[model samples]
Target: MSWNPAQYLRFADARLRPALDLLARIGGDTQPRRIVDLGCGTGNVTRLLLERWPAAAIVGVDSDAAMLACAGSTPSAIGWQLADIASWRAGFSPDLLFSNAALHWLPDHDRLLPELVGQLSPDGILAVQMPANFAEPAHRILRQLAGESPWRDALGAVRMGSILPPADYEQLLRPLCHRLDLWETTYWQVLSGADPIIEWMKGTTLVPFLQRLDDSAAGHFLAAYRERLAAVHPAGPDGTTLFPFKRLFFVARR
Candidate 1:
């Protein structure tokens, strides 16, 4: 799916919060010499890695050229690579394999999670965070609308894949990891502006479905999706919408 860096970064503060929270879990005593930010879109989080360990070699890997271009614009010592995160392999074992809000895009986590852990160096860390809000109204409304009459033909087979339960992730990584930590957080993301929920979805969840329709169809779909969302996530008296989002996080050591 195509990405718009501008749209994606509209709520930069909210998006950055999760990345920072995940980063804080990486113990200060552990200083990685080589770090790979897998699915490091626009280098927002990769730059944070650089600040924490300026001496460490960091590479931001992403599949989209437009996103990478935006990431490469700023002068920095970090490396930006354009490649698919699912099949992409590191030339050398990295001390830290970090991905934020990216791995959920790929299928078959049962195989993918362990493979990533195997690629780490001895005692290397694999820290990741992904959206666990699939059941939330923002996404549920989209799926409901897509399955309806007019939109059914184009979105019927739209398989965005599934995010396995936390227990399943523990089962997959426990054998390979010497130490593993898993937790979930629900952030009441207060968003402002008309159709704030729709704006937020446009950055990530709305991409795939929108890509399948023409301008007119896409517009109508968004309108319907927006109407449904407003009822479920009504704005507060101050006009800010409280969008409760859940995210899953894990830190594993090889």
Candidate 2:
């Protein structure tokens, strides 16, 4: 699916919070020499990696050329490469492999997690964060709408759900690392604007459905989706909507 960098960055501060949280937990005695930002969308979080490890050779790997173009060049030494994270391999084992809100797009974590861990150096750290809010109304409504008439035929067999439970990720990565830190955070984000939830999903979850439909059909889908969301998440007295977003995070030190 194509990505809109502007749409994705609409809530940049909120999105960057979890990346910062993941980075902070990767504390160790030694600083990394080489770092890889897997699926680094627009290099926002990749820039944070640069800040943390100024001397490290940082490479931001993403499949989308649009996002890569938005990432552009950084003042610090950083390489932006267009590559799919599922099959991406660093020329040398990286000291830190960081992925934020990207792994959910790929499937088969049982095999994928181990492969990623194997690419790390002896004392390397793999830090990742993924949205665990699939069960929330924001996501469930998307699946509900997709299963309806017209849309069902248009978006045939498109899998919208991909994230695994926290326990599942722990079981997948525990044996591969010497030390592991796993946790979940639910951010009750107060968003302001008209249909903020819909706007939020447009950048991420809604991309697939919207991409499959034509302009007219996409508008219809959004209209229905907006009605459903507005009912569930009505604006408060202050005219702001509260969106409780949950995310799963892990840090594995090999």
TM-score of each: 0.98, 0.97
Off-target runs (Cα >4 Å) in candidate 1 are none
lDDT, candidate 2, equals 0.89
lDDT, candidate 1, 1-254, per-residue tens: 88999999999999999999999998989999999999989999999999999999999999999999999999999999999988989989999999999999999899888889889999999999999999887878788899998999999778654589999999999999989989999999999998898888889888889899999999999988878888989999999999999999999999
Query: Candidate 2 lDDT, tens digit per residue, 140-234?
Result: 88898899987999876777657888888888888899899999999999999888888888889888888998899999989999999888889
Error of 1 at 76 (Å): 0.4
Candidate 2 residues lying further than 4 Å off, grouped into runs, are 73-75
Q: Against the unseen true structure, what C-alpha lDDT does each candidate score?
A: 0.92, 0.89
Model 1 root mean square deviation, Cα atoms: 0.8
| Per-residue lDDT value at 215 in model 2 | 93
